[model samples]
Target: MKKSLFSKVLFVCLIIPSVLTQAAEVNVYSYRQPFLVEPLFNVFTEKTGVKVNVVFAKKGMAERLAREGQHSPADILLTTDISRLVELHDKDLLQAVDSETLEKAVPEKFQSKDNTWYGLTMRVRNIYSSKRLGQVDLSYEDLADPKYKGRVCTRSGKHPYNVALVSSMIAAHGEEKTLTWLENLKKNLARKPQGSDRGQVQAIHQNLCDLSLGNSYYFGNMLNDEKQKVWADAVNINFPNQANRGAHVNISGVAMAKHAPNAKNALALMEFLVSEQAQQMYAETNMEYPVREGVAVSALVSSWGQFKADELSLETIAQHRKAAIKLLDKAQFDL
Candidate 1:
């Protein structure tokens, strides 16, 4: 009986460590597309020996996390746009992180003041005008001018991208001025606000409009596709507000879940992402500017001349989001 008991105890001991190793994994709820982030995670796994498990969704991961509450299995949340990141933080779904590596890598302006989130990449909001338009220089304010009436194309004002831009306008100007600007911009739309940023580019190609607003990376993505390359070729990217506060910019960022079960692995992955090697891979793969200083942008991205990014803190811009949305509705922007 004693011999049998010893063998069973030995088996249990062997199984337990393997189970613990498997449990060392980090779980990610990501709004970013899988292709954009999987390569970085693979490298993280190879370096740290801690596995990454990602669940991707196009939307509502934040709500899902909130619903999951303290019992949530999510260790980290990866998403694009400052709006979504701020939304997660505002919902109390994210926890503050204290990582010296992240602090050193990311700029103060690009990270949460409370350290709940950090930006991974920078994407400029640029105006794409038909090459036929011939060297038109414009600012965000100029979009509302009567001269450009009926020449603008954009995605829905309700989209997080547009909302963030509108929020910035509210920050630079104010509620009343922003509201008036929205009304004028609404009048300037060639058609009802519709489509993705790429779709707006397509509109410019079709001569439906002479100008559109889009993130810089979408142009790079389009250039990679044979069919879409023609649309990309048709427009010249213009960095708006070069003379003033600088062009509006946004980020793709990540946060830790408030009740992360694998906090150590999650923090490790977060730190790894901001490291020089990972930032380079991130910039090259996504065709975005790395948030970490001195990590070079992709060669293709470099071909586009650099312009000053707006210096406004994202937290200040986030505060105006509600006001921006209200202004959009009041202007009947999407309607």
Candidate 2:
């Protein structure tokens, strides 16, 4: 009986360590689509043997995290757009990270001042003009030119992407000038601002409009789709503001949760994401430019030719978000 009891205790002791090891996991609350992030998590798990649990939602991640407070199981928050990152940081939902790997990989302009978040990839706001239009070079300022009146196509001005762009405009040119630009841009729209970025591309292909504003990646995505390839082929990507402030660029970024349950594993994942292998995968799989210096972009993205990106700090741009939204409303852009 004594021998049997000793064996049972030993068995329980061995199982405890196994269970503890298996519990080493990092949970992610993400605003990015699942397919875009799942593969990276799978790779991270393969290399580190730490499991990853993800909860993806189209929006409201910050609200959810705020509601969860200290009891939240989330270890990381991955999302696109500096505005969203700033929103969470402002709400104190994220914790500052001290990773040299992240600091070294991300540029000063693309990272938080407090090291609360790091940009993972970049996507430029480019002008897509119909091939027949003969407008090879364009500027964001020129989009409002009277000559182009009744020719521009765009999504809703209230869309996050456009708000960010307008925010950058407010950063470069102040609120009054940005407001004027918005009014003129609204006057120039081909129709009531409606549809996705790709829809603008489709409008351009159908000759419904002469030009549209869209992110660089959508061009690549459209080209990869059979039906959309024609729309993609119909327009030439013109990097706006190349001769002046440079094209406005936005980022997809990551931040550590304020009450991370697996902080160590989260840090490991953050470091791994900025590594060369992961940066390259980000470029290839998402068609976004890698935030890490020296990482090559996908061949397709590279073929689009290089142009200077706006040097404005994203934090500064984010600060103008409220003003941008107000200007959009004043301009009645969606009307």
Candidate 3:
């Protein structure tokens, strides 16, 4: 009887390592392009011996998660924009992360109130102007100025990026004022609101419009591209309202999936993503600002000079998303 008990104990010890080894992996569902994120995962794997498996998708993450329910394999969801993260929370596709590391690394303004999502990096919604205009200083509110009528260009107001911008507007100026701002800004469009942010820069290059709104990273990206560098050269990147409330900002962020099969490894990955090593990689590789203070900005990104970002809580801006969309529709913004 004693020999049998000893054998059972030995057997349990032998299997535990095997189980732990098999469990040392995290699965990810990423809305971000693979090229943009794979390197960070590679480094995390090197450091922790935890394998990361990614299923890249352009859309439908929410629907997929809902369908998969409690059996979903995805442990982490990496996505861009506040609304996307908020959508996951509202849909109950995410679970709260109670990591002290995350709470310390990310600012309260950039994380969900319930700690379900944490911002990884930041991008400014900058106003770009033709060099001919020479260092234009304007606020997001100034886009409505009749003086610039028929001289501004932008992507669809309904695009998530612009929608976030409009939400910030509503937070700053309230519904009625933001709607009027949207209508007047629409009247200033050089052509119909159209094309990608790059296309708006191209409009400035071609002299079709004198100013357009675009994310700050697009400037660095355009400068790196062979064809787009010329377009990048045509404009000066402006961080608006520097003297007042400061420029509006947005983020690319991550969340812990509701049904994470590799729960421990998933939490580890989330913690690593906010680590100094990962934050630095994001800044250098993606031309974005690290959410963690003290991570260095790339030289090219730094050359554009620094400006204050509006410190309003992202949670507050997200609350205004529906209102922003409503005003856009009521104003026939894209039309």
Candidate 4:
């Protein structure tokens, strides 16, 4: 009897650790860069004793997830831009999350109707003008005014950032009007749309154009970088259409993988992400607006001051993306 009891005790000890080890780690497939998320993940691991395993990729996450199917080890998907999140949703790659924490912290407009995803941070699609031009007050509609012809610059119209902006336009104004705006806005371009958002700031600095469109976080990002500061300094960040619908906004968000092996841990991490501790940390890390209300933005972001964000639902914006792309093609905006 003593020998049998000893064997049973030994088996219990071995299995407990095996189960604990399996339960303590969660895997993630992130489109967000390591530098942007490493601190948050490190803190989470320290607090919860759950290891985070990550695979970083610039693109093709959907295809990979589809290929992996049920065998995929990914418990969570972290990515920037609503377009990517919507893509994953459309592909049925992510599972719905029904967390009271997320629902309470993330505004309804920033999350999916069914809660498949939730925004972690927000950024505005801002219109930037040259200081040489003085403090110019304008709206998105003003970009197409003949008065500003040959004075505007932007990245490609088809880029996801711009696509979302165009979609917002469609939501605000019907398709016909938006298509006309696109054509006129194209006519106003100082040059063919090309390059990244920062490149548009560079163009403003070089006097290529007096006005351009860019994401608000790029202002903070540029100010932090020694070389880019000059380009940032050359322009003033303007939140367009404060008088109307407010500035267009987008998000960096997260979703649970459909076949998450460590689902419970993923849910815990998801809840932690919306907690004030993680919200403030993540906002500071990315130089973005926290999705959680009442969280203070980083000092630099605060310096930019606050503006009313257009409260349009992101799901509505996602619904209009196809039409926005069609308008871009119709106008030959990039050409």
For each candidate in the order shown, give its overall lDDT on alpha carbons. 0.92, 0.91, 0.93, 0.94
Q: TM-score of model 2 relative to the true fold?
A: 0.94
Residue 102 lDDT in model 3? 98
- Poorest 10 consecutive residues by lDDT, candidate 1: 17-26
Q: Which stretches of candidate 4 lie over 4 Å from their true place?
A: 1-18
**lDDT (10s digit) by residue, model 4, range 240-286:** 99998999999999999999999999999988888898899988977
Looking at model 2, residue 101 earns an lDDT score of 85
Backbone clash tally (model 2): 0
Superposed Cα deviation of residue 251, candidate 4 (Å): 0.4
> How many pairs collide in each candidate, listed in order?
0, 0, 0, 0
Better of 1 and 2 by lDDT: 1
lDDT of 1 by residue, 238-308 (tens): 99999899999999999999999999899999999999999999889878999999888988999988899
What's the candidate order when arranged by decreasing lDDT?
4, 3, 1, 2
RMSD of 4: 2.3
Tell me each candidate's RMSD, in Å, in order: 2.6, 3.1, 2.1, 2.3
TM-score of 3: 0.95
